[model samples]
Target chain A: MADLLQTPLYDFHVEKGAKLVPFAGYEMPVQYPLGVMNEHKHCRAKAGLFDVSHMGQVLLTPKSGNIEDACLALETLVPMDICALKPGRQRYAFFTNDNGGILDDLMVANRGDHLFLVVNAACKDADIAHMKNKISDTCEITVVDDRALVALQGPDAETVLSALIPAVADYKFMDVAIVDYDGMELWISRSGYTGEDGYEISVPADNASVFVSKLSENELVEPIGLGARDSLRLEGGLCLYGNDIDETTTPVEAALTWAIQKARRTGGDREGGFPGAEEVLAQFENGAPRKRAGLLPEGRAPMRAGTKLFSSENSSDEIGEITSGGFGPSVNGPVSMGYLSTEYSAEGTKVFAELRGKRLPAIVTKMPFVAANFKR
Target chain B: MKYTEEHEWLKPEGDVVIVGITQHAADALGELVFVELPEVGTEVEKGEEIVVIESVKAASDITAPLDGEITEVNQDIVDTPTLVNEDPTAAAWFFKMKLKDASEMDGLMDEDAYKALID
Candidate 1:
């Protein structure tokens, strides 16, 4: 096997008795001694610290010294209203390919001088190459490799974080700020992937272990692992890039139309100038052939990814395939999401997942099986 | 007690044998949320998938150790799946099966050999 890369907190994770597994070219902790279910429940009720340092962080600066030029260049790559994004605010966006499929989903923060981007670890290199080849002459892209990112999430996150930086309590959801912690510069954002009220802290790589230790010192905070992270995001109805929204899946087909703001939609001011706008906007007028929907299995057996879904009315006919599925610790049952035929995408539509040679009964239910607790 | 490379353990009691996953397997799998066992009176062959154990992260299938007919299955583990994590080799035994061939036990590994293989 190839040697896996290590994050800044690799030693800390080993010290905490975390089960390490290979993920996205890094050996990351999948769970701790407390186990995945307990860690998942802890994050929902209290605060859980996660090491997300493997994600790529980049700074996009316009060589012309005009922030508008940077936004315009970004608009050509994504379908979001980058010009409308306010300073110090972050938005979720994806890089759309020529065919309207998603190259990668990312979080874009509009800083006053430059744009801050956080991309998925597995797709970062390709995303950088694509951006550089397309817009490097207009905008200078710098990969920030000296920084490490960590997330503190859950219902008690704000309260726990407030103890360290009291001013953080004033920040609302999706707010970003550059703060100083004991002479160390910290880029803190009140946003996370866990669907909980949380903060993502980008700190210097050298200080990451110290920052994580200080946060974990709080009584309510525990070190969570990737296993619970996946379960939490699954319950929140969030899509995993490679699994749920890949290069073959468009935002509209993945039910992520909300990420595309009103300004970029039809009959709006911008009127779709981004890549793949023709095909993507047309899906708004006429719905796509298939749509991503939540699946609730009737029995305890989980319908895992790649499992084929069949229409219950006619068991022999395959309708779709499960893109992501697993046991939701918070919901206390199996929750899954997959694309189904448009006709069978309605809520309460009966379906069957073929698992181990048996057609397990399932139903199309509303997504976000567990309610999001974001502090909006 | 005999062990299989797939991490299942068997304890023979006359023609009927008790079966469960090894503690090593449970530890590697983390907290189990669900367990799907084979129906009683069903015939199973060696290396066939007999049970499925699911954790919050992923699911794994437990294969049959040798050809057998399932005599009984543990309903407790199905209701409370974490029992496998708490005591995989003893209280959390998945099922009891009537062995088809007694000589099949010679092909399994002992505790020391199994420990060496995992370590």
Candidate 2:
């Protein structure tokens, strides 16, 4: 096994009573003394700070100094409308293979002169390699290794963050800003995976500790770990890369068609040019065979990941399996998300999950099991 | 009271023994959100999986520590699982069972041995 790497806030996490665990090649705090349940509730009620520096941050610059060239070049890899993305705005995107399966889901921001992207930690190396192998001839791909990424999530995130970087208050959801603080450049974005309104900030490595420390002085901000992070995102109905959607799961099957802008669809301005355009665009018009659905277990026992799903109580045929399942502290019950056959994927349909040799009833429901609080 | 390597505690009271997880096990599992206990009056052998516990992070199972027939199961932990975190060895006792062979209790670890194992 390779030695696990520590983030810039490693010492800070230890001092704050974090339970460090190995995750995606990094020694990340899985939870603090505050525990996962309270940390999840705290993020919904107030604010929670999460260390996400292990994720890959990359910059793509066009050699011709033209942003349009870079956007068009990137459009060939992802199915989103990169050409229409305005400056200082970020959009969700994913790379697809020839089979229409997702390679990785990422956030791409138009940073005026260059395009900035944040990819998943486990898929970072492969994503960067794919980019370099495909578009390096037209654009310069630079791996950003000198910054620490942190997310301040919850209802109080705006008020708490604006006090430190005053300009953050003006940025709405999905808007990005470059701010100068203490002789360092901080990249801030008003977006997060947790349904709450918040910001994901990229701070220079040298000043990460002090920057996070200053934010923690606020009573509303608590240091959350990977445990709460998973639960919060699960409750928000957002997809975790490997768990919810993987190499075999397509954007249409994953219920991520919303991320695919209309311009990339069958009858749009720039259509059918991405990697799996033929298969993906077809799924958009004629629905996919199976799709992701939200599951609310009737009982308290959580139907964890990999639990098999059946159409009826006594059916022996397996229809699908749960991707993510856990206790939603905000909803005060067990909430889950999984893929099901299109016929069984309706909001009010009944499905049975097999647990401990017994089939338990679950209802297919519309998700964001907790309502989203993003600032428009 | 006797301890199992799996971190369960057994307290003898006449022919029936009260079974619960130790504080060390509770701390390791974090906050318990749900617990599924076996039915009372069911006969079980040692090491049979009988209890299912779900914390906020993951799900785990607790097995039978010794061969016995379940006499009573704790409904408090099932209704409110966090009680196991607050008072694991006492108020959060999972089930009471009458041992088939009481001599099996002698093979379990004492407090000093359990403490040394955790240390």
Candidate 3:
């Protein structure tokens, strides 16, 4: 068994009687005493506080006047439009490798003069190493592990955030801001994994306890663990990094081609060379063989990951596999998303998943099974 | 009344045995939220895990006390899991299974013996 890692809020979780479970090498709270179902419903109805401090936070600043050149260089790694990223804004992007495979999907925020990146904890070391090797020494890359990440998510998240700072409300979706919450400075982003109106606040590790305690003091807020976090993100149609995308799946195959700008993808605007460019550009022209699509199982039963796929209502040849699947509390039903054959990736297309000793019927649907409530 | 080492408490009820979780087990499980009971007529071997009871924190398997076929199931706990917390031995009766080996209960720990196990 691997050794379990502890977050800055680890003691606070133990104090709240949280059931700690090993996840991504960290001994994180799987659920509190209130359980996954209740914690999930609480996030949808009221507000939920999550300790995401396990994710790595990094800062990068250009050497002199090469911010744009550096931004373009960084864009070569991920398919997202980094050059267009305005100051005080954030964008979702994946760090793709030479084969167009996702090294890790991360949130890259352009913080005024510098850059703020939040990557998955499990893949942070590899990501930093890869960035350091690829970028010029002119760029400054510093990992901010001293911060404890906390997310206040829900419709009332804004209300609590507004109380913290009046100017926070002005920030739009995927935007970042550095604000002083009392005496501690925090990097605030209007981004969350739960697909709700929420903010991911990065507080110094030393100040995490008091920050979390004070945040929970609000009557509307409650501590949520990874159990509810999974269910919530499942409902939101968000995929887990290791399960959904890995070193083999590309941006085009994952249906994230929107992140790649046309100029960079094609040779028209001096097709800047990048890793997996040839394969990705080819897939852009002649579509990918498989694509990511949402699955709506016919019955109430959830179609979990690794569940084999068939085309018949009962039995047929195998086609694809479920990547992420679970019960969606808001939908009050089970929903799933997975990679499917391009021929069957259309919305409303019928499909079947082979659950334990049974064939569960499903239909392909558009993503965001639960409507996004971004404070745009 | 006697309890199996697996934490199942059973009471003689005519030709069937009424089963409930032990107080010690309920307390350790924290708050009960959902209970998945086996269907009637389902055959269960002695010491086999026959029920899936989920609490606020985690889901646990409740093992069968003796070899038997389920005669009846209690649906009340499906909606009200706290009944196990309130009265685990009586009001929270899980199900009744007709015994294939009636002498199995004799080998289980009696009330005093079970109390010692808890202590």
Candidate that scores best on TM-score: 2
What is candidate 2's lDDT per residue for A1-376, written digit by digit as tens? 2599999999999999999999999999999999999999999999999999999999999989999989988999999999899999999999999988999999999999899999999999999999999999889999999999999999999899988888888899999989998887999999998999999999999999999999999998999999999999999999999989988998999999999888989899998799988999989889999999999999888988999999998999888899999998888899999999988999988899999889999999999899999998
Pairs that collide in candidate 2 are none
> Which sections of candidate 3 miss by over 4 Å?
A1-3, A267-272, A313-316, B1-7, B20-39, B47-64, B75-94, B109-119
Tens-place lDDT digits, model 2, residues B1-119:
99999999999988899999999999999999999999999999899999999999889989999999999999999999999999998899999999999999999999999999999
Q: Which ranges of candidate 1 are over 4 A from the true structure? A: none
For model 3, residues A234-342, the per-residue Cα lDDT tens digits are: 8887878988889889888888877777667775463636778788888998999999889988765567788888788566677799998866767866688999889
Candidate 1 structure quality by residue, lDDT tens digits, A60-84: 9999999889999999899999988
- CAPRI accuracy category, model 2: high
Q: Best-fitting candidate, measured by lDDT?
A: 2
Position B119, candidate 2: lDDT: 99
So what's the TM-score on candidate 3? Answer: 0.89
True contacts kept of each: 0.94, 0.83, 0.11
Candidate 2: stretches off by over 4 Å:
none
- lDDT of model number 2: 0.94
The DockQ of each candidate is 0.83, 0.89, 0.24
Better of 1 and 3 by lDDT: 1
* Sort by lDDT, top down from the best: 2, 1, 3
